[model samples]
Target: MSYDKDDKRTHLELIQNVVTRMASNSFAIKGWTITLVAALMALSAASGTAKLFFFIAYVPLLAFWILDGYFLSLEKIYRKIYDYVAKDKITNEEYFSLNMTLYISRYNQIENNKYSGFKHVVDACITKTIFPFYIGLTVLVSVVFTLAL
Candidate 1:
């Protein structure tokens, strides 16, 4: 399937848009995580059950951490797709195909790579951009809980 220059450009734009949205979603998830954690902390302090509420807060923190990692992985996947589209290396059959699952296995097959399969989400969780913030929050909660007890 021969694609015109315009067709390829449009396809690339579509992939780029997905990349952008994934990044935006990741950012939003982070924001929500902070907000929820803060609210839960405040509730715990006010309720005099700091231990219980602090523990409960961990639920959202871990949940959001995983969710954020998932979004980050998707962003990475779309980015790889954008690179392929930009290079015009996509096969004739895959031309303009936005299905990302087609590339996930290929990405995983890269030798000795840490970011593969479910590990991709785990890797995303520990990236410089992600790990510190969540770890810091956890430490803060632990310190406060200890002080309260």
Candidate 2:
């Protein structure tokens, strides 16, 4: 696992690419999730069957919420990897041995010290863009559920 200088440089470049991709992926998941939720809201409104779909709506919302959090978590981890490589001049062996969970566990420890799991998840999702979208859907869901009832 000994890397020459050239190999170390190449590996560092690849790690930076991974970090960029992770950030892109996190945003993509957020976009797609919101789109799906919007489609559901439109269908429910058009069909005059809002209550029937409220539970269904919750499915994607909760699933995507967790997924988005997972992606954000991964993105944060890769950023840490990037920092590790840049700061320490990581070896090829160390680079290949990187594990996402190592950083994730550290994140959990820090977050749990301050907040409960539910609170942490909610706080994570409540970013400016994500929160507004979810709040709108929630209001719509409430309206539909109430009207359906």
Candidate 3:
């Protein structure tokens, strides 16, 4: 593939669009988590099914948390790839057929880049938005269940 300045910009824009979708997915996951939690809360309180609903609540919470992290990691890697192409660090062939694994395989080599799936999970655990929201919901579920018992 021949490298053109316009082509690089186009690729970068596409990468950014992917990143945006990843974020949107994360938001959707959060919404689902909240919806499930609320439904579980209602069932527990009204149906006297607190034990089962409370236990089940953890499933969606944990599942979505990990999924959200995975998407964030992907977004981060694509951002790195975008930067490389935009800066002309790699030729068109390398960029066009870029291995998705390139980001995770040689993560440390990229300056200021830490885009591993595991790292994203750790970061999500500590991030103000993700961490607090999930933790709070989990704690709320646990406390409410305990009090019901």
Candidate 4:
């Protein structure tokens, strides 16, 4: 069969397999986002920065606010896609992956490598690691900035 057909078949299988895990991961990331926001607010309150209009002025210390949202948004979308795929609403066969090994097995048969997928469906998990790395950097910078003033 053609690569597209094989790809489709693989995805249908992948969705059947990974959807639950993806959704759970999304919920976890959302939980962390909420906790981070709460903690930041609490810190700013404790610092007496609340005396000023910028009660959460130390937010930058706790987060790169926009980046955190971006990470969370990505996670939300990722989960949403998994949900749709699992329900068969968005029946795009390209989203599934039964195995990279299977791909490698068929790689020699394909005319080209266009079938190589981004693995974005799993990108959320990687970002789960990456966001905190950036969060720490931003928080450190924000703390230095706060101290400088």
Q: Clash number for every model? A: 0, 0, 0, 1
Poorly placed runs, candidate 4 (over 4 Å): 1-15, 48-98, 104-111, 114-149
Q: How many Å off is the CA of 60 in candidate 4?
A: 11
Could you say which candidate leads in TM-score? 1
Candidate 2 lDDT tens digits, 41-128: 7888788677767778888877877777666655556776666666664544465545655544654575574324455555667777
Model 4: per-residue lDDT, tens digit, 1-149? 33465665565566444545544554565566556655655665567564341334445423443444444444454444444444544323334543344434344354354332244323433465555754564575456446644
| Top lDDT hit | 1
Sliding window of 10 residues with minimal summed lDDT for model 3: 91-100
Candidate 4, position 109, lDDT:
51
Off by over 4 Å in 1: 105-115
Residue lDDT tens for model 1, 33-128? 889988988887788788888789899999999998888888888888888778766677677888987665555564344455588899999999
Clashing pairs in 2: none
* Candidate with the larger lDDT of 1 and 2: 1
Once model 1 is optimally superposed onto the true structure by TM-score, how far is the C-alpha of residue 15 displaced, in angstroms?
0.8
Quote the positional error of residue 101 for candidate 2 in Å.
4.9
Off by over 4 Å in 2: 89-92, 101-123, 126-136, 143-149
| Per-candidate local distance difference test | 0.83, 0.67, 0.75, 0.47
